[model samples]
Target: MKVLVTVKRVPDPETTIRVKSDGSGIETDNIKYVINPFDEIALEEALRIKEKLGAGEVVLVSIGDSVVTEQLRTGLAMGADRAILVGCDQDLDSLAVARILAKIVEDEGPQLVLMGKQAIDDDANQAGQMLAALLGWPQATFASEVVLSDDQQAVKVTREVDGGLETIGFALPGIITSDLRLNEPRYASLPGIMKARKKEIKEVAAADLDADMSPRLTINSLEPPTQKEAGKKVETVEELIGLLHDEAKVI
Candidate 1:
């Protein structure tokens, strides 16, 4: 079984984000980058599946420029067999990203594809579903648990929905978007880090994929949220109620 996992480069959750002065985007300078947390969980799940089967490959794929190689190498150190970096410097929206990934999927023909339900930076949870639609494959999103059949022909995924948990089954050659609860990612061991230095990271220019690179959506501007006003102290519950009704307008 070959599992293809999509990895995304995102700002570290702990890092403080500063919007660019021109309102174009966030300032990238002096910011730390890491694999999207949800994508890391997906990669971990792929590694665990390979380890359990004792015979399989876990491949990582990301779309970005040379800078993304750092995150790819980190994933390699986490036990992925190899990586493919689709080189593109321009920002791509979810649909363009999905088209590129679909092209790669066609070329690789992996039995399963795993990726995060959403990227932290944009929070646009559309890629996985769009990719699935492009490939006409079954998809399970927000997956908290995934089980593969002995024959490796089918899979069962338990996912989180608005109401509660939902379990669904699908055959191989499908897509699963992992959620936060899927699994905790492991750190790269010293030996693994050393080995990653030798692992192959193949780069393919995005233009060669023949997928439409045009972005359907555009970011006009980015700005930080306005700071909230400080709270006021009240003498009693009556005062609080009055304030809520008159000032906050909740009552």
Candidate 2:
């Protein structure tokens, strides 16, 4: 079983983000980057699956420029067999990313594809579903648990929905997007890190894939959210009720 996992390099969650002065994008100077947390979970799940089967490949794929290799190396250190980096310097929207991934999926021909439900930077949770749509494959998103059949022909995924947990089954050649509770990602050991340095990281230019690199969506501007007003203390219950009814307009 060959499992293809998508990895994304994102700003470290602890890093402070500031919008560019011209509103084009976030300030990247001196920012720390790491693998997207959800994608890390997805990679971990893929590694676990391969380890359990004892005879499978876990391939990591990422779409970005040379800097993304850092995150790819991290995935390789976590036990991925190899990695593919789709080289693109321009910022791509969700649809463009999906198109690129679809092209890679066709080429790799993996039995399963795993990725994060959403990217932290954009919070756009559209890629996995769009990829499934383009390939006409079954998709299970927000997966918290995944189980593969002994024959490796089918898979069962437990996902989180608005109401509660939902379990679904599908055959191989499908996609699953990892959620927070999927699994705990392991830290790369020293030996693993050293081995990862030797692992192959194949870079393919985005233009070579023949996927449309043109972004369908455009970002007009980005701005920091407005600061909230400080709360006011009410001395009496009647005053609080008046504030809610007339000023706050809740009533």
Best by TM-score: 1
Clashes of 1: 0
Tens-digit lDDT track for model 2 on 2-81?
99999999999999999999999899998999999999999999999998999999999999999999999999998899
Off by over 4 Å in 1: 234-242, 245-251
Once fitted onto the true fold, the runs of candidate 2 whose alpha carbons sit more than 4 angstroms away are: 233-251
Give lDDT tens digits, candidate 1, residues 92-117: 99999999999999999999999999
Per-prediction TM-score, please? 0.95, 0.93
TM-score of 2: 0.93
Q: lDDT of each model, Cα atoms only?
A: 0.96, 0.95
